[model samples]
Target: MKLTFWGAARTTTGSFHLLETRGKRIALDCGLFQGRRSEFFERNRDFPCPPADVHATLLSHAHIDHCGNLPNFVAQGFEGNVFGTNATMDLARTLLLDSAYIQEKDTQFVNKIRARKDEPPVNPLYTVEDVEPCLDLFVEIGYYRTFCFAEGFCGRFIEAGHILGSAQVQLDVEQASGAQHRLVFSGDIGRAGRDILRDPEIPGEAQTLIMECTYGNRPTEPIEGLREELRDLVTRVADRGGKIIIPAFSVGRTQDLVYQLSLLFREGALPQIPIYVDSPLSANVTEIFRNHPECFDRETRDLLRKEHNPFGFETLTYIRDVEESKALNELKEPAVIISASGMCEAGRILHHLRNSIHDPKNCVLIVGFQAEHTLGRRIVEKRPKVRIFGEEHPLRAEVKVLNGFSAHADRDELRDYAFRVQTRSGGMLERIFLVHGEKEAGEDLASYLREALGVEVHFPERGDTFEL
Candidate 1:
């Protein structure tokens, strides 16, 4: 068998990996790369391999960075079954359609500016028309059920604990020489004790492991302190009659924040202030979350049994119509508004940031990883000015980041997970490959694994390929 690093290879955004065996190719993920605009378009618009040649595609989760480019892949002529868990298939349906809509909208926005500057208009990577066919190719596989891709190949999906329907893939291959091997792909490992989702399932055994190291260099704040920190921030903003604007991802991060806030409100720890989820995509994704109680953790399931609707309350409102979303800008009272496109790059979050970021009384909260060169990074860096929708905006809002809300596992947790896999495999886990992280993060984790776990690790670059 052969493996190729197509994306997320020394960087965190695009996550494509190609595996070849028995004259056929399989892609683990085909995610959109997010970064500098020119590079993002060039990378996401094209696939390194001919899409038609691929036999199958297995999706790990529905996050845009992991499953965002499926439409583009299918548009390029790949005609194979896309396998995922039932929840993953359902969530991916919404996420991919939303992604396509965003692409078309963002392209129109950029084209208008380009036309004004006498530059050629760029095309959207994929559109809603392209997403429908991709959805038709989706096939649902239940967790722990093994499915055959070819005569000598089969795999199982283990609970990954990152988001609803996320899974760690385990592939078993039978070589022509009658030798057998197990390969595991750790798709965005989640925190063990994070709220709402269960802890990552233990990877039973494997010979070769490909894992993500998104937080390899950063240690998260104590989980116990997350609620108190959030409560204090919200309380301060409300006391000053100011808005709290949060840039969160629609899938996991947004739901996590809503769940935490619900807990605080139920316990009377937080003041009664109106809370709005401003993105239509988030509202849709939350509905998907409601349908998948099997994905919930013990705590969340308990809450669901009692409250029936853990994501709703008297003060909580989900904004779907554009008029309602725009009305949020007109409100003068204190409120907490959570918006999507977490990097502050797109969606209603841009409008919310533009309207509220200039006020010293207002606060902007960042609750997820901010890749380099993103608007979120600029805010985290406390830049004096930021450009939104091609206009300069003052950055006077108090910018606060809480690392405790992150879904990815930190350095120590990753090390522990690797050790557990190693121990469980009884030294059969010979090769470990780290992907889905920045250069520094991959390097740091590589050193830690080499020194602490004494495992042979490799950090593959984009376009790098290895035969095993």
Candidate 2:
């Protein structure tokens, strides 16, 4: 078998990997690369391998960075099944269409400027029309159920606990010599004992393991402190009649905040401030969350059993109409507004930040990873001024970043997971390929794994390939 690190290698985002076994090629993920505009366009505009030659794609979850580029792949002539959990397929439909819309809107915005300057107009990576074909290819498989995609190949999905329908992918291949090898890919392992989702399943034995090291260099703050900190921040902003703007991803992070806030309001810890989820994508994703009760953790299921909708309450409103979203800025009273595009990239979050950041009493709460050069990172750094809608605005709003609400496992947790997999493998785990992290985080995990378990770890650079 041949394994190739095509996309996410030394950097986070753009999680594409390739596997060739038994004369068949499989694409692991066709995720969009997020970064500088030019690199993002060039990398996602084309596939490293020929699309038609790939027999199938095995998706891990519906996160944009992991599944956003599938449409482009399909548009490029890939006619193969994209297999994932049932919920993943459903969420992917919503998220991929949203991603396509964003790409089209952003490209139009850029092209308008380019037209004035007499520069070449750029096209979107893919359009909504491209999304349907990709959705048609999705094959929903239940967790722990084994299926064969081709002759001499079989695969199964394990609960990953990252988000709804997240799974760890296991693939087995039988060679012409009748020898078999097992390969496991950890798709962004989630933190154990977190709210909403179940704990990540213990990985079984495998001859080769590909895992993410997104939070390998740091330990997450305790979850208990998250609610208290949020309450204090909300109270401070509300006391002064200001809004709290949260730029969250529409799918996982938005749902998480809603559930946590529902708990707070239920306990009377938070005031009766109107909480508006002001993103159309968020409203749709929240509905999907409700539709998939099977993905909920025990605590969330318990809350549901007690006649409470964990994602909703009397004080919460999901705003889908653009006019309704715009009306939120007119209100002078204190409220909590959660918007989409978690990194403060392109979305309604930009409008919310523009309107609220100039107010001294307003608070901009960041609750997710902010990639370098992103507006969210700038806000997290407390920059004096930020550019919104191509205009500069003073950043007088208080800024608060909470890491405890992150879904990814932290340093110690990742180490423990690796150790457990090693022990369960009983020394059969031959090679560990660490991906989905920056250079520093990947290096840190490599050193830790080498020193702790005496395992051979490889931090393959992008485009590097190896024979297994």
* Per-residue alpha-carbon lDDT of candidate 1 for residues 1-468, written as tens digits (9 for 90 to 100): 899998899988889999987788889977888887769878987777899999989988888888888888888899999998889999999988888887788788878977898989888778899999999999999999999977788989999999999999999988767689899999999988888888898786799999999998878887888999999999999999899999999889888898889889988999889999987887678788878888888988998788667777778999888899999999899999999898987788888998999999999999999988788999999999998877789999999999899888988888889999999999798889999999899999999898887878999999998888
lDDT of each: 0.89, 0.87
TM-score of predicted structure 2: 0.96
lDDT for model 2, please.
0.87
Q: What residue runs in model 2 are displaced by over 4 Å at the alpha carbon?
A: 111-120
Query: Would you list the clashing residue pairs of candidate 1?
Result: none
Q: Residue-wise lDDT of candidate 2 within 51-167, one digit each (tens)?
A: 999999999898888999999888888999999998899999999998888778777877886788898988888899989888889999988999999998899999898888899
